[model samples]
Target: MRTAICSGSFDPITLGHLDVIRRAAACFDKVWVCVSPNAEKKNQLFTPEQKLRLVQAAVADLPNVEAELFPGLLADYAVDHGANVIVRGVRNATDFDVEYQMAIINRGIHPQLETMLLPASAEYQHFSSSMVREMIRYHQPLEKYLPASIIPLVRDMTERKGE
Candidate 1:
């Protein structure tokens, strides 16, 4: 099977993330949406459990996609899952540069695994978890950026979490 791992912080899975995951599902026999913590993001909006739940809810419709909380090196997770590809989404030049560098580093760590960068669809190119979190903080509508399945969950959770 051509298994791939789509690793990301996914503090809150957005429409753009769902888009890339949907596409990745079409290409890989199996795709695991690995929810890893972002070391750079010290104050995450959602807890690890909440992030995993949101991701699971968002990707429920995709048969080949599954969400997991991976608290170790991505390369190690890939090996454990028997995944040979790392799927990523690139929205623009800046994103490409960063993802490309990370891809190189991941490749060095797991020589058997390769990274595949998928260009973000135009509608979701500008959407990001950070942007959605900011909007949610100010009580803004998120119908455009978040998956319909998780919109209500996000609102409820954010409110309960005191955001």
Candidate 2:
């Protein structure tokens, strides 16, 4: 069966992320949403486990999709998971440029794996986890950028932070 891995530091899974996963699921026989742990991002609210759970909750309806946490090189994770494709979501030209370079490097490391970029839906093209968190921090409405279930969690986190 054809398998693909979607890797990101989904500190908080946003609707845009879900849309990308949904699209990837339709293309690959099996899709694994791999949450990468990044110690460099100090403001991250969710741990890798927390992020995995959120992604699992968000994509629960997709039978062919699963969520997990992975560390180290993304290409290494893809190889370990038996995935031949790395699915990425591109929201703008800037993202495309960076992702393109990363894809080239990944290809150089694992020539068998291919990176596929999917454009974000126009409505969510500008939505990002950091943006959503910033809005929630300022008591702004995030009903559009996040799933209903995630709003409460974000609110709770913001409240705890006194933001």
Candidate 3:
């Protein structure tokens, strides 16, 4: 079975991420939407558990894809899960650059695995997790960027934008 891992902090999965997952699912036999924790990052709007749950709910419609929390190196996780591909969403040149470097590092660890970059559709090409967090802080509408099911779950983060 051909399997792929879509690794990300997914602090809050966005519609763009969902779009990538959808595309990945169509190509791979199985896709894991992993909410990988990052130790270098200290401030996160959602915990790994919360992110995993949100991802699970948001992607429930996809039968071949599953949401999970992975706490170690992505190559190791891929090996453990028998995944042969790492699917990533490249929204812009910046993302491509970062993911490209990561792709090199991950392949160094597991030479058999490959990284597949799926460029985000035009509508989602301009957004990022940090940008979404900023939008939440400024009380901006999230309907255009995030999965519809995610808004209610993140009310505590976005609803109290001011005062």
Candidate 4:
């Protein structure tokens, strides 16, 4: 099977992230939507488990996609899961610059793995987890950025966190 791992901090899964996963699912036999911890990011809005649940809810309609929480190196996770590709969503040059470096590093770590960068669809290009978090903090409407299935859950989580 051609398996691909689509991973990110996913503090809360945004529409852009879901778009990439859905596209990846059409190309790969299976796609793992992994919720991982980003060492570079601080003050996460949701726990890894909460992120996983949000991811799961967002992608429930995709039969070939599975949501998981992996706190280890993505390269190692890909190797263990028999995934030969790591899929990333790139919205602009900045995203490409970072993903490009990560892809090269990931290649060095797992020689067999390839990185597939999918440009975000125009409608969701401006949507991101950080942007969503900011909106949530201000109690703004999230219907434009998050999946319908997970908006309520995201609201509940943010409310519980007293955001």
Error of 1 at 38 (Å): 1.1
Between 2 and 4, whose lDDT is larger?
A: 4
Off by over 4 Å in 2: 157-163
Task: Please give the lDDT score for candidate 4.
Answer: 0.91
Q: Model 1 TM-score?
A: 0.96
Give the CA lDDT, 0 to 100, for residue 96 in model 3.
92
Per-residue lDDT, model 4, residue 107, is 93
lDDT of 4 by residue, 39-137 (tens): 789878998889999999999999999988888999999998899899999999999999999999999998998999999999988777888889889
lDDT, residue 49, model 1? 90
Model 4 pairs in collision: none
What would the per-residue lDDT of candidate 1 be over residues 73-102, giving only the tens digit for each residue? 998899999998999999999999999998
TM-score of each: 0.96, 0.92, 0.92, 0.97
Rank the models by lDDT, top first.
4, 1, 2, 3
- For model 3, the local distance difference test gives 0.86
Mark the 10 consecutive residues where model 1 has the least summed lDDT. 36-45
Candidate 3, 32-115: lDDT as tens digits? 888898887765777788889889988999999998898889999998899989999997888899999999999999999899
What ranges in model 3 sit over 4 Å off? Answer: 156-163
Model 1 clash pairs are none
